[model samples]
Target: MKTSRLSTALLIAYGIAILGFLYLPLVSVGLASISKARYLSFPIRKYAFGWYEDALTSDTVRDLLVISLKVAGVVTVASMVIGFFGALAFARYNWRFRKTYQKLILLPIFFPQTVLGLALLMWFNALGVVPSWKTAIIAHLVWIAPIATLVVSIRAFSFDAALEEAARDMGANQWQTLREVTIPLLMPGVTSAGLFAFLLSWGNFPLSLFSTGADSTLPEWLFAKMVSGYSPLVPTVGMLTVATSAVLVFGGLILAWAIRRLRPES
Candidate 1:
């Protein structure tokens, strides 16, 4: 009993240490953002919202943030549409080379993102497409769609075909039955997938670096700023991005929970 208790205590301590290691930098940045300092340093004395005010007011930062939001929005929608169909097909059908098809769809996730980005750049150039905001959207979609499909597939594969059959038996056409039955059941996974796609798009730097052209997302903008010089506003911007991401992630969790709660027990 003593040995077990000691082992559990050690495990708890290890977990706390890992959490602190991961989050300490982010926590420090958050504190620095609120500090009334023109330069970041230890021992934050006075706290204010001035840095946040500057972040919001800066035209370049504002434009980059807008770009991030727009790109993320497009990626989220596109991922959902692609994921929905891919999940449906993968879950509801069986065919020759099914496993091969699954591997093909999920290839991007396993590939190194930098290589994927570089390959895409070449592919786009070969196709006579200019790298721009549109190209960034395409690049992000390539990386994130598979993730969305995987997330949605988790719920879809668990779905009983009986429910779909009942709908069909009641004189429902394929489209109507799918719209009324399949979609409702898969909404939780769909919502989570959208959130994943959005967050990944918003934070993606390596992929965006190759395809963003002159239209940079916020993470790209942040990287440029950090590399160029020292500015307290850098930490502030980082803090804002971290906080926004945290909120959206948690909100997505709550939404997923609510969706499950509202869904009828099967």
Candidate 2:
């Protein structure tokens, strides 16, 4: 009883500490965003929607949103294709270096983003190429694909082999079995993986910052906004970003719930 009570207290204390650490700065920035003062001043003078209006009207922010969306979309598509096949191979095949292969594939997740970004930046420079959205998309795909692969492979392991074998034993070909049986079962995992990849690509700062040109992702644009000056509209952008992420994550939850509830219970 004593240990359990102590553990509960520690957990509650940790949660409170983490919440304060995460949200206090955001609260400060949010307050500054609404301030009527020319500069970011704490204990704000007056509140207005001027900053929000400015952010909405800014072409830079608009373009960056488009670029980030495009990059994320491309990364999702690429990760889906790559991860699907990688998962299938891992799930189906018995081959040499299987353990090594799994570790190698997951290596990207262990890599520090700063180091990965710097390495890619140097490689681009060595290749005598200017950093662009194309490069950013490619860099993002490297990291995103591994995560997608891991998600799908784990889910694939849970897949009922009999269904696939029965499909194959019948008239169904390899492709047909995969399409009809394997894919439907794996849909949830794919959705989860795609959502993860999209979020990763969308929010990636170091990689996007180094690889982007005029067409940069949202995080890169946010960095520029921070360095140039703290415009009152900045928090508006932050709020919108937070809202967008919330919607996506919530939508994904709804989807997962729908899938589960609608699925036939064994």
> Number of the top candidate by TM-score?
1
Model 2 over residues 28-143: C-alpha lDDT tens digits? 87787778887877778789978788878889779877888899889988888888888877775668878788888989889988788889889989999888999998789878
Query: In model 2, what are the clashing residue pairs, if there are any?
Result: none
Candidate 1, residue 77: lDDT: 96
Q: Tell me the tens digit of each residue's lDDT in model 1 across 1-266.
A: 35788899999999999999999988998888888887778899889888889989999788888888889999999999899888987776778877888989988998899999999999999999989888999999999999999999998999998999999999999999989998888887888899999999989999999998889888887788778875778888888888789999999888778767876763
Tell me the TM-score of each prediction against the true structure.
0.91, 0.87
Model 2, TM vs. native:
0.87
Give the range where candidate 1 is weakest over 10 consecutive residues by summed lDDT: 257-266
> Could you tell me how far off, in angstroms, the CA of residue 226 lies in candidate 1 after the best superposition?
1.7
Against the reference, the lDDT scores of all candidates come to 0.89, 0.83
Candidate 2 local distance difference test against the native? 0.83
Point out where model 2 deviates above 4 Å: 1-14, 126-129, 264-266
Candidate achieving the largest lDDT: 1
Residue runs of model 1 more than 4 Å from their true location after superposition: 1-3, 36-39, 43-48, 260-266
